[model samples]
Target chain A: MPHDSAGHTPIDMPDDPDARIIRALKALLIGRGFFSADDVRRKIEELQSPAPARGAALVAAAWSDPAFRAHLLADGKVAAAERGVPVLEAGLIVVENTPSLHNLITCTLCSCYPRSLLGQPPPWYTSKAYRARSVRDPRGVLAELGWTPPRGIAIRVHDSTADMRYLVLPRRPDGTEGWPEGDLARLVTRDSMIGVAPALSPSAVGRDPSGI
Target chain B: MDRLRFAIGQRVRIRDLPVPGHMRTPRYVRGRTGEVTQYCGSFRNPETLAYGGNGMPTRGLYRVRLRQGDLWSGYRGSGQDTLEIEIYEHWLAEVGKGAPDAP
Candidate 1:
């Protein structure tokens, strides 16, 4: 029940312990001048600003330029920076999917995702069932998510158990040859970047020409 | 910053030690064997960091690849299926170097 320096407790504070702790810490940090209230607000804004488009842009560039693809696969943070995407994760790894291999990402311990590139993780990504089953039965989870790799193609699951955040560079769908990078980016959905689904097929993109 | 105990491609086993506090090592992989696929660089020990420790002399973090069949008794996927997890150096011990205390 300790009041902040203002001598007033947050009237709207929830009864939840975690939320209370967070609020208390925020007040202490601000009081100590670790960071101003505006800094926290701006950080929240930055985190919520970029959607999947940031990741899609990188995927499209990799699909279009072989050299850029090499750089992306080698150092994703640098690649993202080159394209104006700021990766705030400790490390960013871009895993590639191929004809014989498919990659799936899940944080078995917690929802450790490439948030800076792809925005906040989807609810399913943070669900307990997903955190458990994705490592135990990735193929089954992928199937439930509406994607199943072809027979003989292996599924490799990445468990974000530590500091590194993963972004799956799903294979570019066929029939996208000679397409502009922007149009190609339009086909890269958030699910594809998470490796739960493939990029939108050329025909599917054609169906939603406006992508509305 | 001492020499990393494990190297890429070296086989190691996750220590099955029961840690009481915050730890990044997952339970399922404990006592399981895997190959170090990549040396993900040194990082502050999260177990200590979680408790507000300085976590100095960072430990190495590695991407270890384990066979799905090896992890789960009834794994349904092909033998080629694998799971890659980031494991801290302290949580892993060299396979066959000295057997881990029996579970």
Candidate 2:
């Protein structure tokens, strides 16, 4: 396999149009001293790194501290910054999921997401089926994802179509009243942060640290 | 900052223009009326930015909330269920009279 100066196999092996465009753009910028090949490599590695724990930490803090939760709902960027998590791109909006309401996030135009906090979105999140059906049939999509909100709770779908990215602050699970922040963080899964599922109940995941 | 043309709680309709090129407004919302729920601050217009333009004079962005039933016929789910989207000011037109309390 041939590799570029970045020391990684080319993303498009067979000279696809997208590969060609990216290659040309990288060469032009590098040739112009805009950035180095090292920068490109580092960026790719950074994106590939898994960082869902950062988002879960924020959610854990919000669930345990009322003040933090208020700040998160009011200004997600600041809340993330308070926790030392960087939200560099689009503005962040933390939507709360209450007992009577559920929130789901999607990007119909593209695969825009809170990558700075949650790292790369799941492949399923960027699929055409999800992008098309999320806004149209959110409940159906959630059901297919193995989660279905109760009849009394309404579902609200948010489309990140522009400059703002969304994160769902799922409701704290029951039977976790005295759980420490670290343990609470364990219950906050990536799917829960995306609003596809609720936080894991203590009974489901077990209170023992080893169970997680 | 460009003067904001729409306010929160005001009713507005998304314009369905046929201008081609990079756009953030999805086709599913075109020609649909919704309520402004938030003033999301202004940002560089992606349409101009995509084509190497300066994207000067940032545009005001708002989060509009539309009833799922209004957007889709015979929509299932609670009547209160809705969809929220971020839309630039240019794509929105004022609907009726003054702004009311946002539900």
Q: Which candidate leads in DockQ?
A: 1
lDDT of 2 by residue, B1-103 (tens): 5567887899998877675878998999988899999988989988889999988778899999999989888787778889999999888888864333221
User: TM per model?
Assistant: 0.87, 0.88
Please give, for residues A24-75, the per-residue lDDT of candidate 2 as tens digits. Answer: 9999999999999999999899887848898899999999899999999999
Residues B3-47 of candidate 1 have per-residue lDDT tens digits of: 778888999999877777788888899989999998888999887
Q: Give the Å error, residue A183, model 2.
A: 0.8
Q: Supply the TM-score of chain A against the true chain A for every candidate structure.
A: 0.83, 0.86
In the order shown, the candidates' DockQ scores are: 0.76, 0.73
List model 1 lDDT by residue over A2-114, tens digit each. 75679666577476989989999999999999999999999999878779999999999999999999999998888889899889876999999999999999997778989
Q: List the residue pairs that clash in candidate 2.
A: none
Candidate 1 Cα outliers beyond 4 Å, as residue runs: A1-17, A20-39, A207-212, B99-103
Model 1 score (lDDT): 0.88
- The C-alpha RMSD in Å for every predicted model, in order, reads 6.9, 5.9
